[model samples]
Target: MDGDYVIGGVFSIHYYMHTVKHNYTTMPEPLSCTGSIDSRELRFSRTMVFAIEQINNSTELLPGIKLGYEIYDSCASVSVAVHVAFQLSGGLDPVFNTGDKCSQSGMVMAVVGESGSTPSISMLRVIGPFNIPQVSHFATCACLSDKQHYPSFFRTIPSDQFQADALAKLVKHFGWTWIGAVQSDSDYGNNGMASFLHAARKEGICVEYSESFSRTHPRSRIQRVADVIRRSTAKVVVAFTSTGDMRILLEELSRKPSPPRQWIGSESWVTDPDMLRFSFLAGAIGFGIEKSVIPGLRDFLLDLSPSKVADSPLLTMFWEEAFNCRLVKSFQ
Candidate 1:
């Protein structure tokens, strides 16, 4: 925490957590708290720390100026993300009343992420007027390219417009004119699916049906979407969805005996190790961003010790999940 400039970060450290009854009669309570740690997102958050450490150690980058950071968990929810944004801006509580301002001596100069586009957009509204730059590592919604609206927002990944074009071209190459589309019910999915629909129309492709679902939605709604997918005659399905959203639908599909259809994946779940467990997605193809290996990232992650990171509540949660062990405190 000793540095000239503090970089803020927001990541979806946990996946969506909800329960459903066998008959799906009653609605479950809303997600009122953060869930368990998502190991995939933990890697990205760790990489951010690694990058900052690398820069701080470099003699040429800052010339004796040390870099530090304050990272928060977004939980992949807009409400949670907004609360974290206020904390990053030095708010005393989650509530955002008028006349509130950052009173911290060393304020953050920039923020690194909120992972998904919806959470990023929510955080932008809270921090944009302050002129704090937010650089997202994974948010890819096409709407964020608007300089007038999100002037302080930036991302390392390509926009969804480019991915939509690639998906359209790939479908056309295979001579698949009729297809079905499924996307997450968030800014990323809505905007990306809209762009893909426009691109698909221009390419002379016909979409048989388009459906969307969210993690917090009722189980019956997700079941309806699954039923639509099963009844559809389209042999090709373009899924522009997050891992959490897709997992719900996949679980529903697994219950019924159905033929495997060609699935075109989005970057969100294409390389996800959890998604690969579905045998039905074996032949699925999708677009992924270029990959590069950081020199010491692997060793750094493997060397994480509980004692070294015991002070960090976030890292403590990560340690419990990663190792399935609990630590004892003196007070306890």
Candidate 2:
């Protein structure tokens, strides 16, 4: 999406990256990321494109100026995210000495992503120094609210502190004085769970257990968490996990018969439609962002074709998965 001004988008469209084994003998090959595509994150990227198109078409907004975008997949890696931030900030481009007095600037006027808090933090370290404004849609780590550190950072989602307080209040209201806690082992989950624990203590709540895990952790680690969940005497479980980690844990817990317990979720995974497949998650409660109906947005999203997405490998993959067919390129 090219225009007079470009907005850079950083999204974790892929849930994981291939583990690279380096022999330390030669330069490692380019990083290869292999993982299941995250359809929700894909939608967010398309929505960025859609909104840019709408703004470009509008006669009143920005008047004659055209808005463009450059979207990149972070592949859920902090290193990759930092690399992308540098790219967006023009830090990776080679400088050529042209006989001009004017200074060079990056192609992107601003950035609009890095969906998770840890990745956002990594990106901020790269772009924040350059004074490039970055806004996140889902990164809710409470530490990001420090203006003294992330001066050019902003977000559409509320900080985790508020959500933690709400979750603690919800538990106290339900008389669940004792509960088990699980969190993703990252900035988002770790910081969020810390806030929730602090709030819970103030409300006279006690946690029976607190465990953390990442999606990339070994199966045995995830199983251990599930085993703890199964053995805990607390009837209510508070989970501050991302969708990926939650899915892994649910898969482990569903392997055999297990006692049913009330589940409390964070906004990161609470409203995910994919979690519905786990029957044990019935009656789970959590907070979510308010939903809004955007006029004509549904039609815009549906207006797609093989030809339209031919240039984008990501879109082509998504199309093939959606239609259950392989797309071949014709030389003619």
Candidate 3:
């Protein structure tokens, strides 16, 4: 999409990256991220496009100015995010010199995402120095709220510090003195779990075990965490993890015989509608962000088709999986 000014978007449209182990012999292969598309995050990207179109059609908003976008898939990787941030924030330097520092440059007026807190932080380190504003929809780490560290960073969701306190209180209310803890090994989970642990100590709660994992963790690592949960005596488990990491852990747990225990989750995984597929998690509990209805966003998302999305391989892959059909490409 093209316009007078561009709004850069970063989303975890894919859940995992197929990590390439380099031998450092010749040239390193291109980075490849492989995973099923996240429909919810995909909707977020589409909503950005839809909103821009609406603003372009309006006479009151921005008047004669038109806005465009250059949305990138983070694939939930901090390294990939940093790469894209450079692409969006780069190119501000004048190609030719006019003996003047002033010039019309910069790829985007502002950036609209980087859903995960870790990736957001990586992106901010790159673009924040340039004073580019980055508004996140899901990055909720309490560390990001620091003005000195993240001067140009902002988020729509409440900080995990508040959620951590609330979760600790919830456990105390139930008198679950002995519990197991789990978290993603990223900025969001580490910071959130640290807060929860501090609060839990004040409440005189004792944890039996604390484990961490990520979506990119090896199968053996995921199995080890699941085994810890299975063998633990604690009847309650508090999980401060992202949706992607939680899904990977849960999928591994579901494959083997496991004990029944109470599951407490963070807002990151708790609010995901896709988690409903795990019937064992029927009693899971967690907090959620406030919800609101958008007038025509649903229609715009539902109106997608193969023909319309053919040029976009990411969208085409999603459409194929969703409709359970393959699309044939015609060659000239």
- Per-prediction TM-score to the true structure, in the order listed: 0.87, 0.95, 0.94
Top-TM-score candidate index: 2
lDDT of 2 by residue, 216-238 (tens): 88998999999999998999999
Worst 10 residues of 2 by lDDT: 91-100
Candidate 1 vs candidate 2, lDDT winner = 2
Query: What's the lDDT of the predicted structure labeled candidate 3?
Result: 0.90
Q: Local distance difference test, per candidate?
A: 0.85, 0.89, 0.90
Report model 2's TM-score to 2 decimal places.
Answer: 0.95
Point to the candidate with the largest lDDT: 3
Which pairs clash inside model 1?
A: none
Angstrom error at residue 31, model 1: 9.3
Query: Which of the two candidates, 1 or 2, achieves a greater TM-score against the reference?
Result: 2
| Residue lDDT tens for model 1, 228-283 | 99999998999999877887789889898356699999999887888877889888
What are the per-residue Cα lDDT tens digits for candidate 3 across 1-332?
87889899999999877777889898987666787999999999999999999999999998999898889999999888998899888853346456567543555889999999999999999999888899999999999999999999988889999999999999999999999999999999999999999999999999999998987777999999999999999999999999999999999999995888899999989889999999889899988888999999889988866577787898899988888988876666
Q: Model 1's lDDT to the true fold?
A: 0.85
